[model samples]
Target: MLKPISTPTRELVNLDGVWRFAIDSRAGAEPWTGLLGTPLEAAVPASYNDLFVDPEIRDHVGWVYYQREVRVPRGWGGERVLLRFDAATHAAKVYVDDELAGEHVGGYLPFDVDITDRVAAGERFRLTVAVSGDLSNETIPPGKIEVGMNGKKKQTYFHDFYNYAGLARSVWLHSEPKTRIADVTVVTGFEGATGSVDWTVVTDGVDEARVRVSLSDAAGAPVATGQGASGSLTVPDVTLWQPGAAYLYELTVELLDEGDSVIDSYPVAVGVRTVEVRGHEFLINGEPFYFTGFGKHEDTAVRGKGHDDAYLVHDFQLMEWSGANSFRTSHYPYAEEVLDFADRHGIVVVDETAAVGLNMGVVGGMTGTPPFPTFSEQYAGAATQAAHAEHLRALITRDKNHASVVMWCIANEPASNEEGALEYFTPLVELARELDPTRPLTYAMVMFATFKNDRIIELFDVVSLNRYYGWYIATGDLATAETYLHGDIQGWIDRTGKPIMMTEYGADTQPGVHSVWDQAWTEEYQVDYLAMNHRVFDRFPQFIGEQVWNFADFATSNGIHRVEGNKKGVFTRDRKPKAAAWALRARWRGLEGRKPGSDGSTGAGSGEVTGADGADG
Candidate 1:
């Protein structure tokens, strides 16, 4: 779907503020018919779980309601008005004045509802959105709900992240012309100094509405113009969008009527670039580019999974300060605002789907065995595969045109070692290639997926393995962990010729905890844990990157393994650096913020962090 933007023939209004909220006592209840009897005020664009003092509201297992009255602008009479939602967790059913308007499944994706016939100019109507946090084996991130002995329904999810619900992003009311540009696809490439942009425009109106497209440089000078729905535009001198330096060309598309009068005009800011995964190396613009970053989540204290600009800007600043150049959306698709910021700053991104916790075998990390098995009918069967496939399609369709996204991660730590792994994953891999072949595809593999047992690793261009050697495997024995980690990675080197990246590897360390001896959860131990992993990483030239398990500590489900939340982050949840952070800053800066690839020599003793000795934070 095309993102709603203000154009010459379009008007945009942000409908984000306090809204009347209530917990649903039963399913299929229409709260918009009358005022919700027990309505409480809640803020939009935030997860409702942590915004309340009551535990019932925080841990609710079912549906909730968010309603507000909106007025149609008087100037939007001739245009089509839309109810736009940037995101609604899991699923949302929107109603206009007590009548069902539109609905969408899958959170973290934008959708729109046409309300042109529901209200008139200068009139008011109740806009109600009923959102559900319910999940099942049929959902993207599968889960099971069971009623406890106390008769309260409890949700048991396989994923580690807390299930934050409600409108996690902004809501908007926008107006568009009768004939508007629906969507556009731009594939960019360059040869020598000249650049080529292969463009295609899709319209949603009368077939007779003519299309006109043009490209303009940074100074607003038109470089090329074409009169068609799809064609290629070439520039004499092209400035490529590099890893750290970015350049954008504004593409203006217009729809004209029979008399050559402009009816609708849409603007797109595009960056010309290309991405490829060469043998044992990931390349951008045909040059070897290393990735130095973390896997991130949209988490905060009170807001939960809410998307806030203040946190986003500060997080990027911290990443740059730490000498990081790339990041992954980890288990789910992040808000579009993040990618837009990346586009402007030229940050590499590994766009992932929310197909987390798909494996039913490893219930308690890598060693423990669960009673159930994955890729089966009772667990992640055909129904689960269908839902997972839907998310992949939606993810590519939404993020296909992004310049920052270099690859697609279909799943995180799936049970690719299971018996039916190949049968289950063969089609999904094909589907990803079918949707967008411009980028490579990979999935985060569990520790159980060995070279001998892994059935689906050969399908991917890059081998993205999430390993925990010192922390989860060896457990406080750094020397033994180093030998074990090296031997295990050597299996991959002997088996395949693919470029391998340690997508996740970290030890949970408390920020203030300090110890001279190497002790788990201490700041000093965290530093040593990272150093040992780096030693193993430098031994193999096929090891292309090392993105720590997390950018910052984040909230997770309550369990014996968690202390308040997951502490695997190098930075604290509040964005404070631990001792391990300094160790990474020193190493990555020395590597010029790129992972060691192609070079067999170990890079050490260079790019010192100077000030603090990294003994304590």
Candidate 2:
């Protein structure tokens, strides 16, 4: 869908703040007819799970209700009024007063509805959105609903992260003229400092409107202009967007009438760059690029998967301070605000779909000793595949314009070794490539999907592996872990001969816990674990990138396997640096062995690195 923006012919009003919220128990009908019963206030653009101290609210399964009041601006009488929900977890249904407006599935992506018919202009009416967290085999990121001992439904999934659901992003009231720009897609490239932008404009409701496109430099000076619905614009002496150094050009698309009067206008921030996989290197703008960062989650202290601008800025700042150049939105897509920041700051991103835990026997496989067939009729069958494809379509359409998004990860740790693995992923891979052919594609392969067992590794452009030798397998046996790691890498190299990247590899470490020897879950051990992995990575030319498992600790489902939450973060959930953070800073910044003082400050680095330069140190 076209993102709502304020233009001369369009208006956007942010409807984000406190709203009346209640947990749904299927107790009644016609919920849109009156005020919410026993409604408690909830902050929009945040997950409601951690906002309350009540355990029932935190663990409540199934659907929930969020109600707010909105007024159709009197001036919008002639325009199309729509309600845009940036995101609603899993599934949602919109009700304008007593009429159902629209319904949508998929949690991470945005959905909208035209409320024009339900509400009159200048009239104040109720806007209610019902959000559900329940999942089935037919949904993306599939899971099940189980009744607990208390006879209340609870969500069960294979992933480790908490299922913090609700309205986790901004909602907007927007309006546009009858004839407006519907969609805009742009592809950027550069050859010897001259950048080319191929642009397409899709218009709605207007058949005779003239199309005009223009490109402006960061200084707001016009550089190139064109007339047509689809064409290419070239800028001489153009600046390229690079890692740690971002440059943007504004692309403005406008619709005009026969009299040359402007009817609609929309601008997109364009970063002129190209991404490709060349042998053992990933290239951006014709230069060899390395991915060094983390697989991050949109999580915070109380937000719990919510998109917070403050945390967004801080997280990027911390990543920069640690010399990271890129990151993957690990298991799912993150907020668009985060991607916009990455484009502005020149941070590379490996954008992914919300297709986590699709595997049957390994990470999210059957609960029994034998894993159930993953691609069976009861699991991720045709319906699940369709959902997954639509998810990819929306993801690419929404994010394909960003320069920071260089690669698209189709899934994280799927059971690619299973029977239907190859058949299931073939079309999705084609769809991703067909939708956006400018960038490479990858999927984070679980450790179980080895070269011998994996059936779909050769289909992807790059080999992305999430190997946890020291943590899950060797467990403090680095000497033995090194052997296993080497074998795995060599096997992958011999199997594919394609460039490989480590999307995840880290040990859980508590901040204050220290150990001098090779141990797991200790600060010193975290440092050692990273060093060992890097040491092995440096020896292989096929290993082109290394994005650690996590940037910071995050909340997860309560279990004996976790203490408070996942401690694999180099930094704490509060953004405090652990010993591994310093080790990373040292190696990534070309300095190492710098110990922190008692005041939680980093000391001088040792200034010794072997894995080349720039993030690899």
Candidate 3:
């Protein structure tokens, strides 16, 4: 469905900020059952784990509750009022005045329910949401709470990032006309300097509705216009969206009554570009485009995994300064505003799902041999497969219209070697193709698949590998890593004959630590690690992209091995750059006298590049 847009005729109220919060640790304690005892005030759109000081509150596994009172807009009478959540972690159940309004599974997508019949205009109602981070074997990012020797339980998952839970995104109360536009799907094509757009507009109610679609340039000049629920429009002399020179058009789809008076309208900023993969080449607008960036997470210090505006702005500026043109949403889809900003900045994205629960056996490290136990058993389970499909549908429905999303990564580092993996992924891949034929589909290959020739590689249009050779496997052995990494890339290229992209490759490094002998966790080792990988990447033309493991240090499970969080980020957790950050800047931005991989060999004798001279963009 189209995102609810605020217009003159529609009302949009943000229900963010502080809300009454409580934890329901008792079994069968339904937080939505309306008996919320004097709860503590906590910030909405943030992980509840990090907001409190109590260890129990920070480590609670069961249902966490949020309650708030909202007054419906007095002017929203006779309109279709809806409660929308940008996203809630893992699973959520919503109640309005003790009546169940909606429930949704999966933490990475938006969900809403129409409350028009449940409330009156200008009336105050109690809204409560029960958010659960509990995961079973069937759930994505599969993990379970294990009671330790000290009687303390911890959330152990296969994913490297922390499992931050709660109302992680925004919530809104939106009202539009009873008979208004429901959704709009726009597909664009480019021919020389002209652009053709095919649109499908879906609406609700029985009013005699007519749809008017208009495309305007960046300068507010009309470029193309069309009138229909499903039709095409052509704009002459269209400006194509290119890397570093992003040109966008404002697409406004309006719903009008028989009298031609507009009732509701939705405006989307669109970039006209085409993405395709042809035999080891990633073509954007018919030109090969190399991706150089990081596979990032929506993580900050105090907010946990909450989406923050300041962090977003800072991350974008840092990425641009590092000369990055793209990044995958890593293991899940990010906030909608991030994708919109990417469209504006001409940054390509490999949009992914939160379906990151494939590995259940090997927890702590990557360099382990395994027929890992199937905790989720998702490959053979029908219910898990069905849930995964629904999650994919919701994700595609939400972000399909964005121009920045060049590819769809269905899963990250799944157990491709598992018994029923073929059966599980086959239909999922087919479903993605049916949902979006315009984009390429691929999942990040884990080390298991990389070490051996896996049949699952044949299912993807583009091959993506997330190998940790030097860090996880070789343990600072770059020479041996070079051999393994090069062979792994060649195996995928020979097997699939498709363009390859290294989605995850980085080493954990303490920001201030320095070692003369290139020890692990030292800043010098991190730089050399990346530089070695780049040298190998340059040797193969089939390699189209290289996204480091993470953009910055982020919080993970409080394991015994972890110091604070995952220290693999080029920058520290607080957004300060490390030596590796400068190394990346020099290489990516092509600064004068800063040529990385000049020796094209991995050792202690590697050339040094500095980030000191890097200008803040």
Runs in model 2 deviating more than 4 A are 26-29, 363-370, 591-617
- RMSD per prediction, one decimal? 4.9, 6.3, 5.4
Candidate 2, lDDT over the whole model: 0.83
* Model 3 alpha-carbon drift over 4 Å, by segment: 26-35, 145-154, 206-209, 361-380, 591-617
Candidate 1 lDDT, 348-427, residue by residue in tens = 89999998887766664444354677888888899999988999998898888888989999898888878888998999
lDDT (0 to 1) per candidate:
0.84, 0.83, 0.79
Lowest-lDDT window of 10 residues in candidate 3?
608-617
The sequence of per-residue lDDT tens digits that candidate 2 reaches over residues 1-617 is 78898888889889999998888763266578888875488899999999988887888887788998998888888888999988899899998888889999998999879877777788998988889887888888888888879887778786768888999999999997778888899998878878899998899866533889999999999999998888999999999888888999999998998788888889999998888888867778776676789989888988898899999999999999998889999778998999999999999999999998786665332221225688888788999999999999999999999989999999987878788999999999999989988889999887667777789987898998887767777789987677777777777777787888899898888889876787678888888888888877766766778888789998888878689888889999999999888888877776222211113222221211111000000
Give the better candidate number (2 or 3) by lDDT.
2
Report how far residue 591 has shifted in candidate 2, in Å. Answer: 9.4
lDDT, model 3: 0.79
- Superposed on all Cα atoms, model 3 deviates from the true structure by an RMSD in Å of 5.4
- Candidate 1 regions with alpha-carbon error over 4 angstroms: 26-29, 364-368, 593-598, 601-617
Ranked candidates (TM-score, high to low)? 1, 2, 3
**Candidate 3: lDDT of 193?**
85
Writing each residue's lDDT as its tens digit, candidate 3 over 484-533 gives: 77777766666667888888888889878898886899999999999888
Pick the winner on lDDT between candidates 1 and 2.
Answer: 1
